[model samples]
Target: MIRTATPADVPAVHALIRELAAYEKAPQEARATEEQLREALFGERPAVFAHVAVDDVSGETVGFALWFLNFSTWRGVHGIYLEDLYVSPGARGGGHGRALLTGLAWICVERGYERLEWSVLDWNEPAIGFYEALGARPQDGWTGYRLTDGALAALGGSGH
Candidate 1:
């Protein structure tokens, strides 16, 4: 079952994130601490939200989905931007991943959101197939961009 992650689940969620990082071939990039996750999801004015899938019999956490709301000025509505979704290696080929996604889609429908979207690495053919099977289409002709850490600070300083 998929449910909203509470503060008690921070450690498990962080572990899932690290697992995902390793699967993506960037084990060193998984730097988020459990405290950081707690603050982000449970702090005053939360910046992001997360959901996790639990084993029915074992009650063990098997997957997680982290996301934030995004607004599309052109659509004049808010949508969900999925930051990450990870299913444990041992839990692959099960319905946990789809269940998590279906839960998010339900949230969007309940909230009147225009879309639920995310990006996948071009080399991740399995993931691409999974999403496509769910009837999700890629936004072609668009290139993704990022500005983080030092680059983000440098850009803001230049604006000064």
Candidate 2:
């Protein structure tokens, strides 16, 4: 069954994040700490949300999906932007991934959001195909960019 993640699920979610990073070929890049996750999920002003898939019989966490609300300037509505989605390697092929996405889609429809979206690495053909099969079209000709940590600090200090 799928359910909203509470603060206590931070450890499991963090481990899933690491697994996702490893699947993306960058295990060392997962820098999220359990404390950080707790703060993010249970802070005075929470910045993100998560859902988990649990086994009915074993009561084991089988998957997790982390996302946040993003504003769409064109649509003028708040939409869910999925950041990380991972299903335990042994728990895959059991509809967990699609079930997680369906849950998020239900949230969007219930809230009148215009879209539900996420990014997949260019090399992950399997994932790209999976999303396509779900009727999600890729937005081509769009380039992604990021400025983090030191670069972000430097730019902020530049006082534009």
Clashes of each: 0, 0
Q: What's the lDDT for all of these models? A: 0.94, 0.90
Lowest summed lDDT across 10 adjacent residues in model 1 is found at 85-94
lDDT tens digits by residue: candidate 1, 40-109? 9999999899999999889999999999999999999999999999899788788999999999999999
lDDT of 1: 0.94
Number of backbone clashes in candidate 2? 0
State the lDDT of candidate 2 residue by residue for 10-111, as single tens digits: 888888888888899998888889999999988999989999998778888889989999999998999999998888888888888899999999999999
Question: Scored by Cα lDDT, where does model 2 land?
Answer: 0.90
